[model samples]
Target: MKKLIAIIPLLALCACWYSFTLKPYPDIDTVFVDSFANETDRFELPSAITEGLIGELHSGSILKLATRERAHSVLSGTVTHFGSEAYTYTAGEEPLDFRVTVRARVRFERAGADSPFWDYTVEGFATYPMDESTKSESQAIDEAVSMLISRIMDRLRTG
Candidate 1:
């Protein structure tokens, strides 16, 4: 009986710290994700990143997707880098694997605000075998983009 009574208080305390939903931005409920500007040679990155972000926003309840005219905040970014380099080499110095990396400069701001609430850079990478039959560069790029989306989501959640 004593242990049960003690657990009751502890359970109540734990419940107080629990949240049913995420409120990423307490003051903003809807957001407009702008088409990312591509600065890298990879011309597809802008649309890919933008589409990935939209899919993420749709999957999560943290924020509602809105048009710029109706949005309370804006999320914008620029794809600054995209490249691949040898990650693993054979005994003879032949490339066995490569790492594809993507980087973006992102900002989150309130609608009509002169300054953003947060602005920073996020990067993601993925490795693939050199053999195109097993895994292709396109697959690695997709993985890197997924990782990038996850990092962006993390930033939004924490900020």
Candidate 2:
């Protein structure tokens, strides 16, 4: 009974030592994400990234999705580069795996602001086997897109 009482106080103390709140963008409660501009030859990248971001925002509790007219902030980006290269090769020089990379220039700004508060370049990549036994090129691209979205989310939450 005495040990339990002691642990109770210790647990309460530990709980008080840590607290979490998602107020990363304190000034902005709602955000509008725009369709990313595709500078790469891949025509589907912009829409894919844009839709992925919207889906993330819609599912997350940190930021509410809003229409452009009702948003406190706007997020836009340009898909600057997309490419796939050989990642691994067998002893006979046969391709074993490939790495797909995607890069974007992202901007986050207050609504109607003249300049963005956050402007940065973000990159994401994923590797896939040549055999498609595990993952295919399209799946690798989707994984890369998820990685890119995760980085963007980290930036929003941290900055």
Candidate 3:
């Protein structure tokens, strides 16, 4: 009973601290994510990137989606590269697994700003086994996109 009472106070204090730190970004409410330009020949990659970023920002619950004219900030980018490599091979010299990497250069600019506040080349990769694994190349690409989106949001929030 004594230990439980001590824990209650600590838990209450933690809750208070958490609420105090839950602050949103200043001077920004909505964002516009432009359709990314695809330098590679991958079909529909530009649409995929745009949708992925919108989904992420919405799910993050920190920013509202807006049109280009109404946005307080804009995010634009290009999918610069994407490729796969045979990562694991069987002793018999057969391919057993693959690793896929996706790279992009992103720019985030605030409204009326002359220069972007965040501009970076970000990358994400995933590895999957060949036959027995249920994961597919499409799924790997989705995972990499999610990773890239998360990293971009992290940079925006931290910066």
* TM-score (all chains, Cα) for each model: 0.85, 0.83, 0.78
Arranged by TM-score, best first: 1, 2, 3
Which residue runs of candidate 2 sit more than 4 Å off their true CA positions?
1-21
Worst ten-residue run, lDDT, model 2? Answer: 16-25
lDDT of residue 148 for candidate 3: 78
Candidate 1: segments with Cα more than 4 A from true spot: 1-21
lDDT of 2 by residue, 1-159 (tens): 999998999898877754454576677899999999989999988898899889888986587999999999999999999999999999999999999999999999999999888999999899999988999999999899899989998898777
Clashes of each: 0, 0, 0
Clashing pairs in 2: none
Model 1, range 1-159, lDDT digits (tens) per residue? 999999999998788755644565688999999999999999998899999999999997588899999999999999999999999999999999999999999999999999998999999899989987678999999999999989998888878
- For every candidate in turn, the CA RMSD to the true structure comes to 4.4, 5.8, 6.6
| lDDT, each prediction | 0.92, 0.91, 0.83
Return the top candidate by TM-score. Answer: 1
Candidate 1 displacement at residue 48 in angstroms: 0.5
Instruction: Write out the backbone clash pairs for model 3.
Output: none
- Given candidate 1, what's the lDDT at residue 34? 98
- The order by descending lDDT is 1, 2, 3
